[model samples]
Target: MMHQPMKHNRPPMMKRIADASEPYLYSAPALILIVAVMLVPLVVGISYAFRDIQLLNPFSGGFVGLDHFRALGQDQAFYGALRNTLWWTGASVFLQFTFGLILALLLDKPFYGRGLVQALVFLPWAVPSFLAGLNWAWLFNPVIGPLPHWFYALGLMDEPHNILSDPHLAMWGPIAANVWWGIPFFAITLLAALQAIPRDLYEAASIDGAGPVQRFWSITLPFLAPTIAITVLLRTVWISNFADLIVVMTNGGPADRTQIVASYIFTQAFKRLDFGYASAIALVLLALLLVYSMLIVLLRQTMLNKG
Candidate 1:
């Protein structure tokens, strides 16, 4: 009777192989979709940079290597746009992140109507970028909006003149609009990261006689560092590529003072119908962004290693 115990047989090798491949088979459709939707377009865009692809010309599909880049190298507007892009990206990110961090800290504290306050603060982010740009443009107009009058009242201007028409001051209009629209994104991300920090750690620090500033530096900042770094990187790239507000508000106008690289690309593509040139500029921008991202990642890795 003891020797009569039956043994179970293992599944065939083919069956095991099929089971192992089942997860990949299930995910294949999504992977294919991503490649079709994102990767194919990117590859096509890169190809366009090397070929003449004017939107209106039916016979403009001829390959012209490096001609667009050569032309771009001599374009003064492109150079100006590059400088404007630096100023635009830097100012927008700094102001947005600064105000966002402040707002997140304020929201972290429990208070009456906290939820309502958060919703209101985040409302601007939901507005369409073009509409936000138009709204800010109106605000700068002296005839219809209050900002100009407010500025004049504050003695910052001789009259309620529109700053968007002033080449020196025009960049600020889009930058200001961008900051207002982008702050909520940073605040939402930072607030979530802040809330995820363990309460016990803060309590322990307090129990050990750590001051508020010290606790923030030691506990809060360290926990938020990774989040802040990633968020800043993503926002930097996004804002650099964002042309909607600038195009809608300034149209790269007032002598192209507010024109950034993204807007410049748009001008070449749509206004001039030079898709090849636009794609060339876009490729250069893509290269710069990749280099910038790689540097940031390497720096972060080095800091992590040292820590």
Candidate 2:
């Protein structure tokens, strides 16, 4: 040290830079692919929202600024779609979470035919969404479906009729199918969370004279809270943008009673050939989703802090 550390050699600047960037160099391919596949299309779609881009028009790709957004602001059908979106997302998420938690709780304990029951619970998730929609549509059809007959026998319906064609009840059809298909997601995730919980906590709670409900509220729920918040947020976003089942089952039919924002975008883009308008709608939906996501994240953080 007294002799200037024996004139120890250091790598040149270029060599040091290369060594520092080794990790990024290895990840460069994935980054490039992501930019090309996701970022590029995202930028292009955002540009479309500010232009006149009709697929049928030969010279339609012209900048229109906020014209599409202004028109969207005045579209009554778009407003109706917003309302339906709330109902659809709310009912579907609520029912799926409720039934899924019950199923998960039941499956957490040993029982006869538990394996078969679990398989059946997860079967709907494996089925294609389009196929599931079609199957549910058939099940709601008065001509061939037994549901209407069963409802009639239960004194719940005036007659065996196709509820999907009835505007008053048409929304329930897709909601029911969505709940059935989505329950498996919540069930699987919740069951895993349930299993991860330590047996000692349950034993300790029982020793302290905690009842089933008390134990669940005191121990199980606190452990599952984080998982629940994340799963609910993900499901909410996915379901809000999901139009496949609605398009396949109802096509926003019965006077567009089932039209949601996602399906509305599809109708504009494909049926009307109005790419600009569709992009504008999509941009708005994206903004809304971002806001919702921020709220969920903030709430989760607050809960974590309190805990």
Candidate 3:
């Protein structure tokens, strides 16, 4: 019988080890950075949530268990902030997405000076949140800003009054500013998704006697569904945690009318110098956001499966 040639079933042990270790070696730096930057602070903050960590007190870092949480449970201001957060997040996300989608659709069509228009449209997003807040705050100022006067002229207001100072309308000011600043994010993402869609699909729909609305509903929207879901999810989480515009514009003023959970956390940590309470609030907010995110992801997965 002919002697069978010896077969090599695997690479050398050292080679296999090197191959297995290569990916980890390449990823080690990023893992280390994440741990150092994100994970370390996260662990520390979680620990602080269970302790007394006032910055002004020399001996404040003592373990306090769930006292902070118990206090939070009874804090009516926190409850108010939660309600305001819902309104702020809901209105901001809705208006931003609606206007952004419209802007994206308009820009997707060929037009004169499309580049200039796109640049101008996306300009707000590039502006620092602090600057944007200041600008919007100025605009809402009856003394310096033209918006109040314009509204008065339009009969939307009885007089050219500063809406930012009105507790009933103060939240709207921040929400409006946030919508203006955030719309571009949705627009850019949606525009990219629109461009990625196959041209033939729209053409085919047109050839099948579909009208503009029909084509949009049947072709454009289905393709955009996933992008919309993701962008909305991200924007919701971000806007919930966002405090810059609110802080700069109203400082959660006029009776804490504009105070969201994020601004409340800022107040606790910086203004009150109560790091432990702030950490506890932050931890709760983090948990709530995680839950919201998981629900959205599950919903998206269900939709994708059905589709």
By lDDT, who's the top model here?
A: 3
Each candidate's lDDT (Cα)? 0.94, 0.94, 0.95
Pairs clashing in candidate 1?
none
Q: Kindly list the per-residue Cα lDDT of model 3 for residues 1-307, writing each as its tens digit.
A: 1254536765678977887899899999999999999999999999999999998999889999999999999999999999999999999999999999999999999989999999999999999999999999999998889999999999999999999999999999999899999999999999999999999999898889999999999999999999999999999999999999999999998899999999999999999999999999999999999999999999999999999
What residue runs in model 2 are displaced by over 4 Å at the alpha carbon?
Answer: 1-33
Candidate 1 lDDT over 185-277, as tens digits, reads: 999999999999999999999999999999999999999999999999999999999999999999998999999999999999999999999
Clashing pairs in 3: none
Summing lDDT over every window of 10 consecutive residues in candidate 3, give the lowest-scoring window.
Answer: 1-10
Evaluate model 2: give its lDDT: 0.94
Which digits, one per residue and each the tens of the lDDT, describe model 2 over residues 7-115?
Answer: 5487568867887899999999999999999999999999999999998899889999999999999999999999999999999999999999998998999999999
